[model samples]
Target: MENEISSKSTYRLLYRVKPFLAITFLQFGFAGMDVFSKVALNQGVSNYVLVVYRHAIATAVIAPFAVILDKKVRPKMTFSIFTKLMLLSLLEPVIDQNLYYFGLKYTTATFAAAMYNILPAITFLMACVFGLEKVTLKSIHSQAKVVGTVATVAGAMLMTLVKGPVIELIWTKGRNNQGVKGGGTNIHDSIKGSLMITVGCFSWACFIILQAITLKTYPAELSLTAWICLLGTAQGTIVALVMERGKTSVWSIHWDTKFLAALYSGIVCSGLAYYIQGVVMKDRGPVFVTAFNPLSMIIVAVMSSFILAEQMYLGRVIGAIVIVAGLYFVVWGKSKEYKSGSPSTDGQMVQDKQMTDTSSDSNENSTPEVITLNVSSRGGATRDEQINRQSDQLLV
Candidate 1:
């Protein structure tokens, strides 16, 4: 009995922390992708071609599971959903990814990862613009989010504009600078890379927002991920061909870091990450899904210093610290907002149940109905509406 009780306790604990573990593992995978992708790019792998190959591999790996597991749950694909999928592919797989690779080429992996820390801020801003987020000035949580967004942007600028003295680590100390200039040494390259990454973040934010919107009509995470990868592969191939033109050699693959990088990034970052994030977003919402980006930045900073002999600066460190602080503010505010709203949500659910019961009693022949609670008073639907829609669909 004691053993069984202990096993149940363990299971409950794992269930409670599952999302945390999943997102943390995702950060490790993303950090590895940054490091390996940097190495592969250094070894003459074309960023355009890399994007194509990555999506191709992702499609191949993810399609089968999507076909089998999501067969029943997958919604009928409409032209609207198809169009959204195309745009989704374009945003992340083609535009955002290409720009990110170009930025990574100009900047160190650590810098690029640090720059990505602003993703939640970008996502929050976009959500607000789209009416998916409510910004009430009187709310303390809203105030925290606004201040956090500003702090995040300021930190990004500091990281981009200021390159202080190098803070050498034991791994990077006394090492030959490996023919690679520190990201901050060249002002022009830093500006160029920073611009590309910042723009890429916007594209990424758009992708995430659209993804949440798309999931309303198409709720199958696996199938949706497969479609995105397959469509992205097609779109990315066209972009690669145009960019590489006559440079067929850029497509060549060998048993080296280049091929390994493509394989790892495809399966881990593109395929698994998309599916996992989609699942998490259904429950926690988009902002929650992006809140953990700083974890990957921290991982990349340490891994790059040890593995790539990348030099870190005091300014970058300070910026990273500030970014992390801003990220937590956003997360804490979101959490508090959710907690404060839970009682209302519960009350709404009970009211919905009472209405359903009343309708059933009034008409004996009436079929059970699914109630979609539009919790947001704003003009646009929030993630709560999406969740309610998904639940309604499941009931049907």
Candidate 2:
């Protein structure tokens, strides 16, 4: 019993921390995506074109995994659900990619990351408004969630609006003094870039909320992911075909560091990372999956400094601090709430409990004796104690 209790408690603690970790890793992962992608795109790979190629390659890679372990998958081939998954793919991969790349044209990488700090707060509000998530102020955990979200948003605003000191650059004359000299992507451009990326971030946030519902009908996350990526690939290809079909030379192959970067991103970043994320989502849930965005920010910040020499301005530092503080509150609030209200045997939710009786069937027919129990939290204020019906638990 004590072992069971300890395991259950540990699970609960992990669950509470899940969101923070998910968002952190996501942020870091995307940081790599942002920097590498910009380099590739600069060499004439439009974001649209890159996403098209990436989705196609990723779907091809994921195909073998999905096909090999077909038995363990769930949701068993339904057309209606397939349609929904495809639609979601359009929302996240297609629309989101367009916004992101378009924004990148105008914004610096650091500025984009700074604005994106608002995503978690935006997601929470969107989820609640859409009836996809429930929030309450009755519990300290819920309140903490609220407070953290607010602070994070405020920090994003700070980073977005404040201008940092500009650095001067001396560029070698390019044939006739053309091509990137003396000034960076201007402050105005950064603001514009920040705005566009913020829109993209919110679009992604919407996708996160939709994920919970998507998982219910399409339990095979890998299968659903394959469909989504395939659909997204189709969409991106269509867009590319329409736009870059004439300038096909711009999209020509060049085996260089950029090509290697794209290959890594397509195969490992988009392909493998996405699959693993879904697997974790199945076990951990959506909030757990998305909570790791902050880690990406820190990673990106360090990378941008060494790789791009982007300055760590006071604004960005303050924003990072604020966002991290918010992350702490959200995690803490969830943990405290889970402890107080979530069902427990001395603060641990029950696992499989069987109630067996040794009485004769005749005497037990009219009276109840033993019952079964299973427990999970619904993130409510009340101490949620759910007693579900059992298959063969005996009475008396």
Candidate 3:
């Protein structure tokens, strides 16, 4: 009896903390991707080539699975949907990713990850500008979000401006730095990299806002991912050809670190990461998924110190702390807004709840997990409601 009680308690605890754990795990995966990508870039792989190979591989791997899984729920691909996917491809896998890789080549993994902290604030600003989100000073929740945005931007600036004394690590203090390419201590390049990363973050913000818009029209996440990868692969190849003009040697990646980097990034980061992200977005929201990005910065900082022998400093520590605090504030505000029944969110939740309720009645013998899985995509289009209107109509 006691063991049964303990088991139930443990299950409850795990359920409560699952979202936090899931996002942390996702961030760790992203950190691994960053490390491997840096290794490839340091081995003289052109940023354009890396993007081309990664997206190309991702498309090949993901396309069949996406098509098979979404065959029933997948709607007809209109030209309009195709155009939006193309735009998404341009914003992310093309411009944003290229700039990010170029900047990463010039900066430490920690610095690159830290610069990503600006993305949430920039996204909020973009959302407001596009009228996707409202900013009312009357609501404490809105005010808190605004303050968090400012603090996050300030923290990023401090990280860029201040380079205090290096804080030596016990394990890496005296290690030979022969293999650590662009590993810290390059102020000029770091500054330039930081600027480039900031611009990349802005583009990433645009991608997120636009993704939210696109999800309204095309709700098949997996299919959309495949198309984006396919388009990005094509675009990246063109850019690579132009940039590496007459240097066909750059495309001939030796079966070495560069090849390994490309393999890992394509399978883990591009393909699996997209599926995981879509699942998380369906369960939580896009804002919730992005709120966890700061975790990657911390992971990269620790890994860079031990693996790459990168030196940390007091300035970075302080800036990281501030950025994390701001992230929490924004998350807190967002949560409050969600709970307070904001019309937009409330309407979405209610409409989705109705669809789930109807579907459950029709598919009475279906398992609870199936219902939850299908209903989690609540933030998306009303077409999802149509998809669920008839339980005879398969739910993917």
Candidate 4:
């Protein structure tokens, strides 16, 4: 009886902090990747080769797990879903990641991360245009989201355009003065790099919109992620071969920092990060997932300062604070909206029981679907079971 009580308390604690923990893990992992990738890029590793190796490793690791974990209830693959996955591969690892890494090669990691703060606004606009989001200006929730988006945009621009006084950090300055040299972030290169990251953000927004739609058809998160990695590996390999054609030296990987970059990024940033995101999106919503992106900016900024001895300007600090404020506003609005609009516990319990019945009766000749996915819902139905039931309904 005592043991059972302990276990229940642990479960309750974990459930309460899951969202915070997930986003925190993601930001730290991503920040580490940024630092490692920068070091590899500085060591003259080709961006295309980095992409190929990263995705290849991600595919290998994720595929077996996906197959094993999702085998029982995994939906059969269709040509249509495969086509959409292919497009997703092209959008993310191909266009978005390629541009992002290349831009990272030229700019400071802090700046590169700050540029990504614009993604929420870009995604919000795309969602509105695609009819996925319904915006009522009269609603405080909607207004908060809109204003937060605008603030995020303003913060990004401020960081990009305005370079102010450097905030003195004694540790970074003293350490750097002792013969350590930071990477160059020249004005001209910074401009070019910023533009690339901006475009990458646009591609990422498109990817999110498409991924949401695709999840309606292909509800198997792990399976979908594995497919994306596999296809992305192929696409990245083709790009790498084309770019490094006749240059055998570019393909060489020593058991050094470059190799570590590929391995760590493949396992953590690509495979695990994407999987965590899929789970988070299914539990919460996309806005909630993206709302934590600004946290990454903060993480990267602090990490870059300590690791690279990178200078922090007043503008960057001020802008990052603004971005974080905006992020909280957006999250607050989303939370309020979810609470106000979401169904009560009794209704959710009824739906959960209905879904359980539908899933038990489901068979192969079914289309998968998911509906009303909310983080705050206190239903007994698990996310996967919910998706399974939705898939069963699709068949009808």
Candidate 5:
């Protein structure tokens, strides 16, 4: 963690300099979680079983906070809201985590994280269509938002199709030295892991957009998170029951390295991550919150290459840059545009009130002169002349 922020300047700015620093760190934490899980799996643990624990522990971790908030701050949990929660759990915990872990089983964590760069772009498009976000070109902020989204998306696609080195990287120093490879070739010769990660990104994107909606209806961030995990736990249990095929092994408590991995994921990545995401999204919107996908990719890539001795590619570095550049354009532009649209707000109201008063006075006074206007214009006064004529008559 100390090495995670080597530069004092980077720390002061990233941890303190920016407005959305917390959100940025949250995204980085998610990436770090993925890297750690990958390290744990190389030590020999079923990814699916690990996921089962992730949701379970995540539920426990978030449950108390949820309960307190549910009792006090969050909205009353109507069946309707609960139903939405259930649906959202399916998208996030069930599909999102499942696809991610499954993809990790088949692919490298770096590959998965790299592919996740699509999330912000997907979230932006979905939010815009859902009317949860607004995008315009009249302002630089809007332009940045749009271009950033495009850059992230384009980078994701480029990584997938660019035919870069997707090699397996085994850590020779580790007990199991056979996990690393040089190419992304699967036994099936397909980028199934990459595909699965894309699905994961897409599902998470939907989860984000829906979350914006969820917050509107149920503003209790803590409560919403707890219930979402609860629902995900239910959905995951059912799937694990069916997929593991009557084998209770997936449910059996291992409490080993794998369980610890899950615990970290549950407590930090899921529970705390949700809390942080909710808090930031309240200020930053889903687009910017999700926009840090590239940062996560960078974390995963760097951690994999040096810590795990995985092969790093020139393309990964370049693609990451492109994605980050895109994110910069989008978030900066969107925020700027939002600010630009707001400055005239107070002034506009004041000017409107003054105009209304002037019009009303003119209407009241001009009515008496309305009939005389035609005659006044013939020999009678014009709009300005009438005022002068009235003044003269009053003086006489």
Candidate 6:
């Protein structure tokens, strides 16, 4: 009886911490991608080629599952949905990723990772502009979101403009000179890279917003992901062919870091991360998933220092801290906003809760379940609710 009781307690504990463990592992996976991609870039992989190959591999890895699993509830694709899929492909996989890789080429992985923390702030601003986010001056949570966005932008600016003395760690201490020479320490390159990364963040923010819009019509998560990957692969190839016109050698892959980078990022980050986050988000909320994003930055900073001998700057450390604080404030505000029970918000929440309960019931009965927006009643859901739901889906 005691053994059985202990087993039940253990199971309960595992159930409770499962999300945390999964998210932490995802952070580590993302951190490894940054490190590996950097190594591949250093070894002469073209950023454009990398983008194309990455999505191709991702499509291949994810397509079969999408076909087999999402067959029952996959929405019929319309011209509008197809158009949005193309734009989505253009935004993230082609533009954002190529720019991001170029930025990563010119900057350290740690810096690129740190700069990505501004994504939520950018998304919030875009949502406000589109009227998908209601900002009440009287609400503390609204105030928090505005203040947090400002702080995040300020932190990003500081990171861009300031370059303080390097803070050497045990791994990077003795090789300070080598690190300084090898790292992206040049002022011009730093500024250029920072611009690219910031622009990429904006593009990524746009992608998130548009994805939310797209999900209203096409709601099968796996199928939609496969479509994005497949379309992105095609679009990225065209861009790569144009950009890498004369460099046929850049397309060549061998049993090397470049191939591994593409393989790992496609399989782990793009493919598996999507499914895992979706599963976790179904249990917890989207906010819970996004709350762990900064963990990837922290992990990247540590791993880059140890593996790549990347040097940290005082300005960067300070900027990273401020950005994390701002991120926390924004996430806290969002959580509160969701909990605030205004009529429309409450209605949406109740509907979502009912959907979740229904899905849970189906799962218990060993039936495949897919959560989809009721197209007939789509007009009833407010833009804010739609955006919130999209945020939940795309953030994965």
RMSD values for the candidates in order, in angstroms, are 6.2, 8.0, 5.8, 6.4, 14.8, 7.0
The Cα RMSD of model 5 versus the native structure comes to 14.8
Estimate TM-scores for all models: 0.83, 0.76, 0.82, 0.84, 0.75, 0.79
- Candidate 6 overall Cα lDDT vs. reference? 0.72
Which 10 consecutive residues of model 2 have the lowest summed lDDT? 387-396
lDDT of 4 by residue, 1-396 (tens): 576555655654565468768977988888888888887887888889998899899999999999999897577788998899999999988899899988997787888888998888888887777655657888888889888888888888888777799889876776541232224346777888989999999998888778766766666788888988899999998988988899889888989999999999988888887778766655555566677787888888888888877888899888988988898788777666655544312123224434754575575444444254442446556544544454445444
Candidate with top lDDT is: 1
Segments in model 2 whose C-alpha atoms lie over 4 Å from true places: 1-24, 164-184, 280-285, 339-396
Candidates sorted by lDDT, best first: 1, 4, 3, 6, 5, 2
Candidate 2 per-residue C-alpha lDDT over 153-175 given as tens digits, one digit per residue, 9 for 90 to 100: 87777766765653332321122
Best by TM-score: 4
lDDT of 6 by residue, 90-181 (tens): 89888998998999988888888877777766776665575446678788887886777767766766665676998878777766424442
lDDT of 5 by residue, 238-328 (tens): 7877788767655555657677788889888878877777766654567767887788887887676766665666567678778878877
For each of the candidates, give the backbone clash count. Answer: 0, 17, 0, 2, 17, 0
Model 6 worst lDDT window (10 residues): 341-350
- Residue 319: error of model 6 in Å? 2.1
What is candidate 1's local distance difference test score? 0.78
RMSD of 2: 8.0
lDDT at residue 337 of model 1 (Cα atoms) = 70
| CA lDDT scores, all candidates in order | 0.78, 0.62, 0.73, 0.76, 0.68, 0.72
